[model samples]
Target: MAWTRLLPVADLPVGMARTVRVGLDDVLVCRLDDQRVHVLEDVCSHDDAPLGDQEIEGGCVTCPRHGARFDIESGAVRRSPAPVGIATYPARIQDSWVEADLED
Candidate 1:
């Protein structure tokens, strides 16, 4: 797997999310806390709504359109209306930058 640098770790505030384009994919990168970060697809599974602007609470992102909530870390379905979970990517911090494996 190849790790692609998205942005600086310091640029991403804790408990917030940002969208980055890697190749042809629009990835949503969320910083859950000081030490944890999650990368997932930017679209909601059920209605294909964009999740980039959704609010994150309790480690889950609630879809603004239909009220579907999904866990940021594991891409699990936390609340219905989503029906299924989205795709998650492996993320890490290296050289003070946030990186994610886009090969998967």
Candidate 2:
């Protein structure tokens, strides 16, 4: 796994997510709080729709298109309309920047 710097910690607002390009894939970088952050694939598991500009609560992100809730950390399915779980990456804050361990 290769760690890539996506953005600054200050750039990601708490309780929100930002989409970043990792190689040819779009990943969602979510900041749960000042100390916790998670990364997931940008697509919804239920449908082929993008997951962003949505609401996050209780460590899950609600898919805007179908309202499927997915756990940001473990990529677990938290709601219906999603037959599977999303893919999650290892994320951490390094030198005031958000870094994710993604495939290289």
Candidate 3:
């Protein structure tokens, strides 16, 4: 397991998601409630839409293209219109910076 620094914790606003290219993967890093961080595949399972540009509500993010809702923590497809689920990455905080590990 290799970890790469994504961004500073302060760079992400609460309840918002940001897109970062880690290695060759496009990952979405989200700052949820309680300043918890979640990292997931930026692509939406419904039609391969990027979730970084979508809208986030509560702990879920809605795909802007097809309106698919997914849980940021578990990568679960909470709403229909999307039958598949996206990949999730493990994240951690170190020295006020957010980092994520993805199997490449």
Candidate 4:
């Protein structure tokens, strides 16, 4: 598997996510519950809006444009208008840094 270093773990706060560029795509990397990190496509499935600019609550991030909600853990579109699912990247914390695998 190919792993790309995204950011230092200190840069990501628990319960929050940040946008990182992987190749030509922007990904939302989330540091969740002090356990695992989740990476989802930054653009919302609805209207192609950016999910990173929206507020994060519980485990979901809402789409700022159309109010579509997405579960960060699974990249599931929990709300409508975003009927399609998002692409997810495997993520982990290694050596005090956050790394994501975009090989898939």
Candidate 5:
């Protein structure tokens, strides 16, 4: 897996989502808490809308375009209108930096 360092952990606020570019792919990085973070594809499966700026609530992210909500941890479609789940990348914090495996 090609793990790319996205940003420092301090740059990401807890309970918020940030969009980072790894090559041509746009990844949504959600910092759930002090010890957990999730990385997901920044696009909605249903309408191809950007999920970057969506709000993170209770481990779920609500798509701003059509109100489709997805679980940040598993990338599962929690609310309908989204027929499929989005892609999730493995993420880790090392040396106080957030890294995401984009190889998959």
Candidate 6:
């Protein structure tokens, strides 16, 4: 898989979700802690709403449109109203930047 550098780790504050355009996809990036970060698609599975800027609840974020909570790291569905899980990318911190492999 190819890795694309999204943004600097310092720009992503903890507990805040940021949206970045990667190719034709809108990617959601969130930094949970100093050593933990997550990358995923910015769309909700239930109603196609943007998942960006959602508040972090532990390791998950709830869809504002439908209240469907999903794990930001693995994209697993944690609450109802979502029929499926979101898409998560393999992410890593390289050279002080957050990089993600969007090609999957």
Q: Estimate each model's TM-score.
A: 0.92, 0.92, 0.90, 0.91, 0.95, 0.93
Rank order by TM-score, top first? 5, 6, 1, 2, 4, 3
Worst-scoring 10-residue span by lDDT in model 1: 49-58
Query: Tens digits of per-residue lDDT for model 4 on 2-101?
Result: 8889999898888788888777978898888667888888998778987774346878888878888888888988888898888888888999889888
Question: Over the full model, what C-alpha lDDT does candidate 5 score relative to the true structure?
Answer: 0.90
Cand. 1 TM to true fold: 0.92
With candidate 6 superimposed using the best TM-score fit, by how many Å does residue 30's alpha carbon deviate from the native?
1.3
Report RMSD (Å) for each prediction in the order shown.
1.2, 1.4, 1.5, 1.4, 1.0, 1.1
Ranking by lDDT: 5, 6, 2, 1, 3, 4
5 versus 6: better TM-score goes to:
5
lDDT of 6 at 12: 88
> lDDT by residue for model 2 over 11-57, one digit each (tens)?
88899888888678888999999998898999998877889765578
lDDT head-to-head 3 vs 4, winner: 3
RMSD of 4: 1.4
Candidate with top lDDT is 5
Q: Give me the displacement of residue 26 in model 4, in angstroms.
A: 0.8
Q: lDDT (CA) for every model shown?
A: 0.87, 0.88, 0.84, 0.83, 0.90, 0.88
After superposition, the stretches of candidate 1 with alpha carbons farther than 4 Å from their true spots are none
Cα deviation at 67, candidate 6, in Å, is 1.0
After best superposition, candidate 4 residue 60: deviation in angstroms? 0.8
Worst 10 residues of 4 by lDDT: 50-59
Shift of residue 38 alpha carbon in model 6, Å:
1.0
Model 5 TM-score is 0.95
